[model samples]
Target: MNHLGSHKLNNVLGQILLAKRMGKTRVIAETGAGQHGVATAASAAKFGMKTYALFSENDQVAPVYSISAGLAYPGVGPEHAFFKDSGRVEYVAATDDEAVDALLLLTRKEGILPAIESSHAIAEAVKRAPQLSKDNIIIVNVSGRGDKDVAAIADYLEKRNTKNQE
Candidate 1:
């Protein structure tokens, strides 16, 4: 199994564990690649809690493949299955913003904290999603250090700045 060591992953699990200890009934998470989604789902199953994972329509190809592999794992597949037989645990939204809204609605209705990895798309979703008064925790997965994203971020910022000035 290919393992990825990341502080972000650790922090996300810590938050989920803390929420579970607080008597939360469920956990909701949004993922782009299904990495975080599968991880959260596995963790929730370990704790005997129901897990709900949200995915955008543009989910990368790798995640679907990973999910299939995860399901193929022998003993791991039966008890702690990542993919549901009926696909009930997976919710697909038309857009990233819709995914965020669905997650937020789940949290508001179920009183569960949702963990969402931060991406350029999610930033937009956060802005467009409905206002949720209840406290919701969003976990952002930083794939590459900002050194790689700085150029893109700066370009976006400059464009927005120019738009605002005009």
Candidate 2:
């Protein structure tokens, strides 16, 4: 399937566009893996908007993801933080194991290998899908492909297998 390498870029661009439409001169955001920050900076530059990206110095989940699937990030986008605070978006943390499970499920079912970040979103959707009406549609942003995570996932699964056998 053809997909954006960093799907989150679309959101960042959309926010920038909205800010521009509203006559804002500056765009500020925070990012974890630098993807959103990079995307925001690029979009802002395109529109001649001043941009700032505040990255987190410490984030608990970043290290684990870095080791497990190489999807670690120090922080999320500031807009995401704002949405969480305003009740427009709910933030959920998925463990490496859960994300791996989601990755496997998606790969097996849809034949698509999703990035670790995208796996987190997929895992969240799996958790919420059962509660929603059948008519409801859930859209997940698959920010990137999992080609880079193949080795990491293999290592994770090998360790898991060893642990299960022991």
Candidate achieving the largest lDDT: 2
TM-score per model over all chains: 0.35, 0.59
lDDT of 2 by residue, 91-115 (tens): 6778878888999999999999998
Consecutive 10-residue window with the lowest summed lDDT within model 2: 59-68
| Candidate 1: tens digits of C-alpha lDDT, residues 1-166 | 3253322355456646775776664666655455666666666676787776666566542433111121222112221233443365532223434433434454467554343322333444455446654476555343322333335445555775798799
| Clashing pairs for predicted structure model 2, backbone only | 7-143, 32-75
- Evaluated at residue 35, the lDDT of candidate 2 is 62
Query: How many steric overlaps are in each model, in order?
Result: 1, 2
Model 1 accuracy (lDDT, Cα): 0.47
Query: How many steric overlaps does candidate 1 have?
Result: 1
- Residue 5 in model 1: lDDT: 35
